[model samples]
Target chain A: MRVCVLNGFDSEEMTVAQERKLEQELEVLNQKGDTVDYFKLRDRKIAYCLGCWDCWLKTPGECRIKDEQEDILKSFVKTDHLVFVSNVRLGFVTATLKKTMDRLIPNFLPYIRVYQNEFHHYPRYEKTPILHTRLIVDHTVERDEIDLIEDYFKRVALNFGSDLKSFKIIDGKGEEDYEFADM
Target chain B: MLICNGSPRGEMSNSATIAKWFLKDQDKVILLMKGPKHQEYLDILAAYDHIVFIYPLYVDAMPGIVKAFFERVAIADGLMAGKKVSFIIHSGFPESVHLEVLERYHRILSKKLGFVLADTIVIPGSEGFRLMPPKQNRKKQQDVMKLMDQFRIDQPFDDHLVRRLAGKRQSNKMRNFIFSLLEKTGITNLYWNSNLKRNNAYNKRFDKPYTEL
Candidate 1:
């Protein structure tokens, strides 16, 4: 399976030990025969979505902003499994990941559809990747905050015409307990 | 009082309309969140005892720019603590169910950041609110004005009024069927279709660019 890990970790907050553990986890996935592709979002130049309807109206499934996000958008639709890796901030994923998510409008059309008695956009592609979130949280985070994050991701998956296959919250210790094989 | 406009479109956004209408007389300065003035805005926000954050929902959550502002707030650490915060979240969809989880998140976020939760106002059918004719949106605007008039800076929204403003959580089967019929007749997508036609991309509306990959 092809897995795309979009890491949105803050460089200042990521500890050396946590960085090593992340590498070790990816290595384990590699040994397990999963084609792992990782993108560190902080290193790339991605602009915020201008809320311009150009992607939907003018360009048609293409964002007008000329930036590094085009490759990420292509990979997102082509991958078998897309993993969102980010450290929790303000009870949700980092803004880096959120900005990337906003730019993904090109994956869907400008039209609307009725699904399960609710309004949603139509998918532009024939298939979409299964979604997953691997969030790192501090001990101060509460159970409700975790639940809220899970619930929000579930809604995102549903809207994207996929299911949230897995959601893993990794603390500093016992990182080995959660494996990529589970995904 | 501090009012933050979290829409990427900045002042021209529909979220800005709500902010302007809500505080018509008092301070009318709406802080745009999509700019490079994060630290300056944070400094201004720290002095206010009450804050009103208005943003259009993007992908069923706060806009990325709004989340970016929250990240800065998280870093500030206690700068917003105990400040009464009210959120006005609007979305394009007519149903309020899509925004319920985000509203719940705001409730928990107040606790997490040590801010006092004033209220969360969810406005649906907000896609083209600013572009629509005033006569057509008069009733909806009146409803919001009534709600805002009753709003107390230090307290949560009135439960009865909040429920009324949210309209329906989800459409019933008959309503969905009617909407589907409208969609088939192409009345529901007039806004999108017109924009597509103007851009000359209406012929390629359903074009799938990434299918080959």
Candidate 2:
């Protein structure tokens, strides 16, 4: 499987122990012969989407701004499964990840299509990736926050004509408790 | 009070037009939320007792610029407790359901920041105001004017007005059929097509740059 992992954690937020656990998770995927493309978003320069609609109409499936985001968008469409790893801040994903999400609109055409009884932008690519969200937190997150995050990602997946395959939360207390389940 | 324009286009955004109309005769500073001046804006926001956020929905939620602001707010040493916050979210899509999750997230955000969620007013099909002439969006403009009247008196957004502004939530079969037809006939995408034509990229409107490898 061609799996792409987008890590939205900053240096201070990623503890040494947490890094080791993440390596273990990546190793598991690597051992299974899955080709993984990991992108640390904090290190990359991704500009905010200017709401220019150039990607849809002017350039057509291409963002005009020259940045590192083009590579991420390229990897995103080619990947079979997409994983978003971010530490929760302000009850949701980090700003780096949110910026990445905002820039993803270029991957879809501007034309509106009726899907699931609502309007959504048409996909620019034929294959939509299976999505997974993994959140890292220091303490227990509220159940409502978890559900709301999952639900929002579900909507994100829906917009891409895909489904959220799993929602995971890695609790970083005493012992590493992996509370991830396939949906 | 403070009005923050979270649109990436800064002052030229459709949200700016709405904010101006909403402000009318009110004496409030409309701060444009550019990326560099986060600390300055945070300090200004801390001083205000009430804040209004006006922005178009980007990718089904707050724009990256606005999300960045929220992250700053989470750690900033500001007394947000008892402060009132309101949101004026508009989007190109014609369905109110697209903004529901964002509305819920705003509630969570208010709780986390210890602020009062005054109200969330969503305006779907807001692209018409930007794409068409002023006369075409007169009704929407009038509705916003009425909403402004309520905002001045410190009263919560009237439920009936909120519902009317929200427009349609779910699409029935007949509505879907009509929209599909409009899409097929290029009527729904007239604005996009016109812009593409102006830019001489109409022929490549459906070009897919990121094909699956």
Fnat per predicted structure, each in turn: 0.85, 0.80
**Candidate 1: clashing pairs of residues:** none
**What lDDT score belongs to each candidate, Candidate 1 first?**
0.81, 0.81
* Tens digits of lDDT, candidate 1, A1-97: 8888888886655544555677787889899888888888888899988899798999898889989998888887778988887777778878898
- Give the top-scoring candidate (DockQ): 1
lDDT of 2 by residue, A53-124 (tens): 888878988999989998888999898888888887788777888899899888898888999888998998
lDDT: worst 10-residue window of model 2 chain A = A174-183
User: Each prediction's interface RMSD?
Assistant: 1.2, 1.3
Task: Provide per-model DockQ scores.
Answer: 0.78, 0.76
Q: Write the per-residue lDDT of candidate 1 for residues B1-213, one digit (tens) a residue.
A: 678888998888898777656666555355565468888887888877778788888887988888888878878989889888888898988899999988998987897789988778888888877787777777667766666665544444667777777889998889889988999999988989999999899998887676676
Q: Kindly list the per-residue Cα lDDT of model 2 for residues B89-200, writing each as its tens digit.
A: 9988888998999989889888898998888889998774654677777777777767766765678777888889898887788999999988888898887788899999
Model 1 has an lDDT value of 0.81
Candidate 2: residue B93 lDDT (0-100): 88
Candidate 2 ranges with C-alpha deviation above 4 Å:
A14-16, A174-183, B29-33
